[model samples]
Target: MQVKEEKEFTIQKRRCLVVWVYSLKQLKTLKRYGLIHYVSRRMKYVVIYMNEEDIEQSEEKINGLHFVRKVERSYRPDVEMNFAEKIGTKAAYQYKEEEGFEVEEISTQIRLAENV
Candidate 1:
């Protein structure tokens, strides 16, 4: 008789795209609650939204026991683009002047998760 091997999923950390109206207070909450960290190898963009802060906080609390990695900040362009793509058709767009600056506006708000 042959035995079947069970595959295991190693989920140490999770990525969350938080959406908010932009506020320093919310950002602080995310950091204070340990809901945010630095995803160095995978990314380099810092995303700390308001709505997901609560959920991320809870996740941190739970995962703390297992010493699992929590949320992290990324500031890399590639990561930012990937994040935008993951958000579906939301993100935003930018318009640049022929010889000046650039302007950006939100195309839509598509929060994949209600909480996080």
Candidate 2:
């Protein structure tokens, strides 16, 4: 005579995209498209956080941009590291440093979405 309750998963699976752009001019375009989590001035790259599905939908368009160098998919291997850990890999950091930015003080601006 007992009823079982079902649990719901309201959280969506989101992934971080490390997008490399040749120039800051493309920032306007990216801003217009939305979904950017943090923009790093050091490497001329921005970290975009979005539901995996949404990224899949726009991947082609973003990758097609001549200004965009690459879009790296950063994922979590375990819960220990923070969100930015993926991009903090040695190779990635080296690339940023070679670009002339102080790796330790890589500047980033966080963007908040009012309507996510």
Candidate 3:
């Protein structure tokens, strides 16, 4: 009996590109660059996810499009996401009350009007 070997699946590293366009009509042309993750119709921006290796080339191509206003790379991958060390630390959770602020009190008593 021959044993079948299972192939190992690997996750590809990807980066997000925030592309701002003058109009949404050119969305079909932008689809060739990367996978569209999100589109903000009101804000006129599109979020695209592409393999990290191809990000630079994709950014340049997308920027050349006349409809595109600007292309920005997402910094999420570079930012540290670990909060384990900060979690439960006093400084991390400390709330400081503002000083020198006073609240004026208003009397709540309502006086009934006497008949004229």
Candidate 4:
């Protein structure tokens, strides 16, 4: 007869966005909490993945720290949203999502906001 033991791991089901902070101390604080696997940096934003329920609490903690910039929830496109549109009127159309002007237009809007 053979006996086997199985180890169970806790699966994280919640998703979140963590803004990247410029302070080493702040990063250390977040790392100390065993939450350092999901960090993404874009421009001045740091996107992190965590439980949705912990977003507000985590943002509050990070904001309370020094040298941290404004914290706001980051938005991601829904996977279910249909995004397979061809960009031009050609017989051999291509699914060039990036070729579309949506993101560029949005970026222009953002730049305009910065000027205001």
Using lDDT as the measure, the top candidate is 3
User: TM-scores for all candidates?
Assistant: 0.21, 0.53, 0.69, 0.43
Error of 4 at 38 (Å): 6.4
Report the C-alpha lDDT of model 1 over 1-102, residue by residue, as the tens digit. 999999999644444542222223334444644445333323333344233335556545534433333433333423544555676545345444575665
lDDT of 4 by residue, 2-111 (tens): 98889899876555455656654456566532355555444444555667667777778767767667675645523444434543346346566676644344443345
lDDT of 3 by residue, 1-116 (tens): 99999999999999999999999998899898889999999999999999999998889889898999999999999989977665767665556686445679998876678742
Q: Rank the candidates by lDDT, best first.
A: 3, 2, 4, 1
TM-score of 3: 0.69
lDDT of 2 by residue, 3-115 (tens): 99999979887777788999877787876444788888877998877777787766677888899999887766335656466676655645544558544777887777974
User: Candidate 1: deviation at residue 72, Å?
Assistant: 16
Segments in model 3 whose C-alpha atoms lie over 4 Å from true places: 1-5, 87-116
RMSD of 4: 17.6
The better candidate by lDDT, 1 or 4, is 4
What TM-score does candidate 4 get on C-alpha atoms? 0.43
Q: What do the candidate models score in CA lDDT, each in turn?
A: 0.43, 0.76, 0.90, 0.58
- Provide the lowest-lDDT 10-residue window in model 4: 101-110
